[model samples]
Structures are given as structure tokens and as C-alpha cells.
Target: MALLPVDDALQLILADARPIADIEHVPLHEAWGRIVAEPLIAMRDQPPFAASAMDGYAVVAADTAEPGATLRVVGESAAGHGFTGAIGRGETVRIFTGAPVPQGADAILIQENARPLETTMIGVVEPVQAGRFVRRAGLDFHRGETVIAKGAMLDAGRLTLAAAMNLPALPMHRRPRVAILATGDELVPPGADPRDDQIIASNSFGVAAIVKEAGGEPIDLGIAADTLAALNRSIDAAQAAGADILVTLGGASVGDHDLVRKVLESRGLELAFWKIAMRPGKPLMSGRIGPMHVLGLPGNPVSSLVCSHVFLTPLIAKLVGRTHHVQAVDAILDVDLAENDLRQDYLRAAMHRRPDGTLVATPATRQDSSMMRVFAEADGLVVRPPFAPEAKAGDAVRAILLRHI
Candidate 1:
């Protein structure tokens, strides 16, 4: 069978994905980083009335027209407390920031511009124009207005705004639950005394991190030995946990011990595609068992991570209604590169910025997929298209950054 193109495989995995319909009401404090399921409408106008913007006297603009005019202090207005009586001509109200402006007052005579007189009055030192220092009602937001629209992520700022909108709780979509299973008898959990032949299972942890960063909840199924019964038990556990996606690490390729695909197929998985035309992650598999999406990732550490970035990230993003895009930036190659082959290449490279702000990428001398140390030390992956010609140093190339430089 022909290997599927990377783009085609990704499209198939995400084509049928729809935003989760399971909605839950979450308290304001816990709503952060959750997707809003319904519009958050303002309960009342911000401030709900004309308010003083500064700690000054609230007065009719006309009353402060004269440079040295004296006005009687009618009442005081502080935050959450308003002067009930109206402000007549030649009258002013002692007010502080966020205080509601007394009725019939159109401006504020700032304290710096006002001189204190007897206990009952203040002398105007400077005049303030009408509407000056007065925050109009509904200036920030009006009652019944949509403060936050549906499908918006409740970030810090958005959550604050929702709280200001008088919403104690927000309707949010349920976080997508992803079940992660590691396969292979040669694997052991981290912090275990593994035999010389067995290696610690590390791919699930990285994949789980990616799942979380994509706004999904990761449910670890631990390491499953390379056997049909073990794989079946894990699959059942994932279903019991109501996982939306099942990610199987290792046992995906066409090796004698590769049984992830076979086991999933027996469970009635509708195979989407297996094997992608890309280096470092060629033996990738994607399918769906009923409502649960199934992804069989390669066993190699680098391959699993690269595939996660390329395929699984987008799938989870789609499920949660988050926009996902691969950020690729142009860079100048600092070293020569060989011509391409049938598969797309992702070369791990170090990155530097020139004094002129130009980015430079230097691919590692060794590009082995299992070299976790080399992959860890590199900054990003330099993308090489299939069958591209050899390029010399100083050539322009595109690299996908793993982190900020």
C-alpha cells in the first residue's frame, strides 16, 4: 500500500471532528483556559451611572467657570455610595474615584484645581469643562450587551471581564479526554529498575503534555505489554474513562512485533490511514473506533514527538474548537545540505539570530530519529521538502521553532 502524504493523513483525522457538545457550568475561578459555551451578557451597565474618574469635587461645569468661585459642599460620594440629592447651581459634592456623580452634575473640579475653604465649602482654583473627569454611564459596557461571545477561550483577561460582567459561573465546553497507552514488552515505566534490555516508557509523557497544551485532559493507561489481551484491556479502560481520543505509543510500524494496528482493527476501528511519507515519523497510523479517535504513533522518541506536533495536536484542537496552526519561520542555512528523497525530511537544528535580526539555522551533523539527546539539544526542525535539490550554506529555508529563541 502507498504511504499517505502528511497533509492527507492529517485531513482525514480532523475531517470528521466536531467541537464537543458536552457543556458544563464552571465557576469563574475555574473557568480560566476553558472554552466558553455560551455568550456572557452584562447584567448591568459598567458603573451603572455617571461616575467620577478622579478624587475631586463633582459640580456643574458652569459652576466652575469662574476661576476663584466658591461652592457649598452638599454631600459626599465614595465608591458604592452615591450622593442622593441633586447638585444645584453653586453646589459641589465631595467625591472620590469610581464614585457615582451626583445627579445634575456634568463635570468635576479636581482637588488639585480646588482650594479648601470653611468646613462647608471649597474654593475653585481652576475650572473644569463639562463632561471632564466624568465617566459616562455604559462607557465601558452597556447592560444586556454580550461581554464575551461563545466559543471564546477564558483567558485571564477574559475571565476578569466575565467577572466584571456579573457572571458568577460561565457555561463551558467539557474538556476533551484523551487516553494515552504505551505498548511494547521492551518498555518499563519511569523510575523503575529496568533490565538492561528494557527501556523506560517515555513517549506517553511527552504525548500527554502535548495533549494538555492542546486543551485536552490526558488519561494515562500506563504501559501495556505487547499482547492482544493487554491491548484489549487498555482499550476497554479507555472506553470506560470516556476518552475522546486513544493514542497508542509504539507497536505501530510493520514489524513482527507491531500489533497496535491489528488490535485496533479487531476492535472495529475504521482505519483512516497508516504510514506517512515523512522522515522521523513514517510509520504513523490514524483511525477511529466508534466515537474514539485512534492514533498509533511510532516507538522512537523523536518520531512520536514529531508526529504529535504534526497530527495529534491538530486533532485535539479540532475537538475542543481551538485554532491550530504550525508556525514556520524562514531562516538562512548556516551549513550545506544534501538533496532530498521520496520522503519529507525534518532536520533538527540549532538557531541563532544575526545582529541584523536575521535568523540562521544549523542542522545537527547526525539526524538519527532515536537520538533523544541530539533532539533535546536542538532548537527546532528545519523542513526539507520531498525531492528538493541540494542547497549550499546561506540558502533560505523554513524551520518550525520548538521554542522561543
Candidate 2:
């Protein structure tokens, strides 16, 4: 049978994905990067009282009609303290920034615009207008008003807003949990002394990083020996951990040692599809086991990372209610091209900003699947359609940027 298209596979992977319904009460200072579960209302008006915005005289505007107008200084007002008496005609209060504007004062006369005549008197050197340099009550926000909408991501700015609203704790959606398992008897974790034929396992680290970056909590299950019993034990642990998504690396393709698909199926996993029509990651498996979504990735280093960028990140975004996605853009090819076949191609490539401000992508000479170094140094993946025609250098192409260069 032909392989499933990339778009179709993504739709299947995300079909059942839904934002978690559980709500958590997170402290205001620790609510960053969480999704708001309910609308955040202001508890009190920002700047509860009319405040002085400058370190100068809080005056009745009519007292400072023109330059050099004399006014008697009544009392002093500093931050967190207010003048008890009201300001009358031809009288002003010595006020500091953030101090409550005294009653009957309509404006502030900055010190630069006023000359001190004595400890209790000053001459206005500039005209003072009503409501100038005075922060009115409720100017920023009002009591019982909605400050943040539901489903909004609690970024740094939003967290500051929540604090200003007097919110001690915020209602947030629970974070999605992802469990990752790596298979193959030849694989070992880093820093371990490996035997002659064994190699360090790396796919799980990359996969877990992708999950965390996409706003999910990743629980590493370590490497499971290539046996059905070991695999079953790992599966049991993942389910017991209450993981919402389970990701398994290697053993996805049909091989003598590949037993992941068979074991999962025997445990009642509903296999959605086995493969996709994409190069660098064709033998991709997607299915569901009970309430947990499963993604079986290819063993090749480049293939696993590419698939994670294409599928795993999107699934995590859907589960957390995030709206942004990695986007593909048109670019110029800086090297010669060749014709393609049935599978869509994602070639690791370096990108350059040309003198004319155009972005150019040049594919690596060797497009091997196991080369982890290539993917590391690559700025993007140069995309080629199936059955694409041969092309020359400087031709227009499309690429998905891994990160900003």
C-alpha cells in the first residue's frame, strides 16, 4: 500500500488532541508560560487615589495663572503618605512622585517651573494647566474589570498585569505530560561505558527537548531492551505515570527486531497509519493506546528530529492551546537540484542572507539519514515536492527554518 501523505498523517495525529480540562491554581509569580483557565479580574483600581506624577507642587491650577505667580506652600506629601488638609486658592502642597494628590488640587507644577521664595512660599515660573501631570484614579484599570481574557498565554507582560490586578494566584490549565521511551539493545544512555557494538542513545534527549520546548512536561523512560517483555514493562510504567502522550523511538519499521507495533497492537492500540510519504522520516507510526496518543519515530538521527519538528511539536501545541506553529517560507536555491520521486523531501541545508537581502538555502552534498552533525549545523530544511523537476542554481524553492540564523 502507498504511504499516507504528510498532511493526512498530521491530521490523524492531532484529531483527538484537546486542551486539558483540569485547572490549577498557580501563584501569580509562577504563572508564566501557563494558559489562563478563567478570565482574570482586577481586585482594586490601579492607583486607588488620584496621584501626583511629578516631584513638585500639587496646586489648585487657578492659583498658577501665569509665570511668577506667588502661592503659599501648605503641607508636604510623599509616597505612601498624603496631606490631610485641602489646598485652597493661592495655596499649594509640596508633593513627591507617586504621592496622593491632595484634595482640591487639580494639577502639578514641576519644580523646574517654580522658584522657591521661602520654606512656606514659592513663585510659579510657568503656567500650570488643570489635570496636568496628575494620574487620575482608575486611569490604568478599574475594580472588578477583566484584565486578562481566558485562554491567554501568561507571558512576562501578562504576568505583570496579573500582579498589578492584585491576583495572588491565577487559574491555569494543567500542563500536558509526555512520556518518551527509547528501544534497541545496542543503545545506551550518555556517560555509560558501551560495549563494542553498542552506541550512546540520543533520540530520547532530542525528543524530550522538543516536547519541553513545545510546552509539555517530558518524562524520560530510559532505554528498553529489544524484547517484548521489557517493552511491556516500560509501557506499563508510562501508563501508570499518567502520561497523556507516549513517544517511542526506533522499532517502528517492519524488521526482524522491530516489535513495538506488534506489542502495542496486541495491547489494544488502534493503529491509525504505519508510514508517511516523506523522506528522512517515512517509516513513521501513529496510533492511540487507551487515552494516550502514541508516536513511533524512526531510529535514524536526522529522521527522528525532522519528524519531531513536523509532528510532535504540533501535537503538543494543540494539547496546550498554543496557536503558533513553525512556518515554511519560499527561498532561493543556492545550488543545483535534481528530480525527486514519490516521497516528499526535507533536505538539511545551510542558509545565507544574500547582498540583495534574499535568503538562499544550499543542501548538503551528502543527504544521509544518520548524520546528526548535519542537522545540528543546518539552519533549515530545503523542501522539495514529490516528482519535482530538475532545477539549476538561483532557482526559487521553499524551506522551513529551524531557528533564526
Over the stretch 100-177, how does candidate 2's per-residue lDDT look in tens digits?
Answer: 999999999999998989989999899889999999999999999998999999889999989999999999888888
Model 1, poorest ten-residue lDDT window? Answer: 316-325
Predicted candidate 1 versus true structure: per-residue lDDT over 75-169, tens digit per residue: 99999888998989999899999999999899988899888899989999888899999999999899999888888998889988888889899
Model 1 stretches astray by more than 4 angstroms: 81-84, 118-120
Q: After superposition, how far is residue 109 of candidate 1 from its true place, in Å?
A: 2.2
lDDT for predicted candidate 1 compared with the true structure:
0.90
Q: Give the lDDT of residue 277 in candidate 2.
A: 94
